[model samples]
Target: MRLYSVIIPVYNRPDEVDELLESLTRQTYNHFEVLVVEDGSSKRCDGIVEKYTNKLRLTYFYKPNSGQGFSRNFGFEKAKGDFLVVFDSDCIIPDHYFETVEKYLDKHQLDAYGGPDRAHDSFTPTQKAISYSMTSVFTTGGIRGGKKRVGAFHPRSFNMGISKEVYQKTKGYKITRMGEDIEFSIRIIELGFKTGLIEDAYVYHKRRTSLSQFYKQLHFFGRARINISRFYPDEIKLVHMLPVVFTLGFFLMWVLPVVSPVLFFIAFTVFISFFGLIFFDAFAKEKSLQVAALSVGAAFTQLFAYGVGFLTEGWRKLVKG
Candidate 1:
């Protein structure tokens, strides 16, 4: 069994880190170590790491405030495992997460790999709704989900892994914020590093509890698309344009009805039916009217937020050029 180093860069979230640590201690795969790198956070999480000392093979390091990319590289420098795994502080992995990853990696000898994320059963209705909007194939055509991934297998850092040899060759994460993970993945591929997807090794990503927070998070995500485009101009695909198109269509959907009732009626009915399908699916699974209702708003917010962010960043680059 190859050893794994689970590196997590944390800042200002003691409680969430504690929960994540506990989940790690419960993993069924025992050949892994956890490293928590403090990114110059005012609220130190060292005390929380101490509590898990008895149960987990954990290491804690503190460095001056740098971006996640730098912090992850810091951890990798000290990592003793053959595989380096990166995760956000707010994620919960199942007991079989490493087992699932090892099994997949053994079958497919990729230099790096990434898993998917979903809302846990214990997650709040808001989180679940947000997850639905983020991952639903029928909603966004599986841009974020691993099961039916579209386009290239761009390994996300939140649930990503790399062999020790690859890390040494590529020098680990170089970019700092926003789209660092994506930029790193692109570089990995460019360097001839093999990458694959571990669809079953999913994690519970408690990304944001409120719609406002979710909007801000995705807004940056949308901007990342433009960031990545600078590196790989032709990699940007039609699917990347969906959010912008949706944003434009969203406004037109409201205006078309007023201008021409016949066209408006036809468009509105089609839009509502498609929207209703997602809502009903959430309602049926969650058995909560609140989840159903919030799903609609969440879906809209996801599209609109990403759309605006993409356009905003693209416009910024255009102006700078």
Candidate 2:
């Protein structure tokens, strides 16, 4: 069996790190090494990660407070596995996750494979909606085609794995605060590699629990998109524009309320209702007040943040140019 290197970038979440480490130790696929890249987390977390030193083939590296993309690049330099699989600290993988990934690639002769992320049992409806919305073409900014292969240049690191060949070709992730996965995937595609999606390999993601946290998450994501624009100028298109559009829609509803209240009200309702359909679908499999609230809040807050952030990004880019 070829060895797999799992690089986890962590900062300020010692508890989640412990949970992730425990989950990794339970993996049935034993031929892997774990690299915990600490992005200037507190001393407390350093102590926590140290406990796992003897338990597994784990290495901990500390860098200044760089963001996830940069931290991941740091970890990649230390990895020696034939395949590198990146996972966030908030995820819980099944025992068969790595085994499935390895087999899927070997059998299919695929160099890169990405899978759908499963929701954790604790996710509220809003978190679920946010997760689902982010996965679809609306947020992902994928090139549209009916082809079975999507996300060639729009890869998400949530549950993605790639061979060392792609890594050497792409030279790891560019240092950015947002859309690092997407940008990296774009480079991978530019370098000419085929990406395959594996439906069965799922990683359960633990989402943000509160509305405040959700908004901040989107705020950063939006700002990151702005940061990414510095590198990929044309990336300002639709998938990146959705946040801006939603923000504009909300602003216009208020700005034009007096002139055309009826039309504005109807347009707002229809727009929200369309998203509401997606929210309902998110909660169809599960039900609860917390879930319902989260579903709505997740959608609104994320779109709001993304929209606001995109404008901020655009303004900054304009000034720089």
> Which model scores highest in TM-score?
1
Q: What is the lDDT of candidate 1?
A: 0.88
The C-alpha TM-scores of every prediction are: 0.95, 0.87
Model 2 lDDT tens row, 149-183:
33343446867788899988888887645778878
Q: Write the per-residue lDDT of candidate 1 for residues 222-281, one digit (tens) a residue.
A: 898888888778767888788898888878988986699998888888778878998898
Query: Alpha-carbon error at 159 in model 2, in Å?
Result: 2.7
lDDT of model 2, residue 199? 74
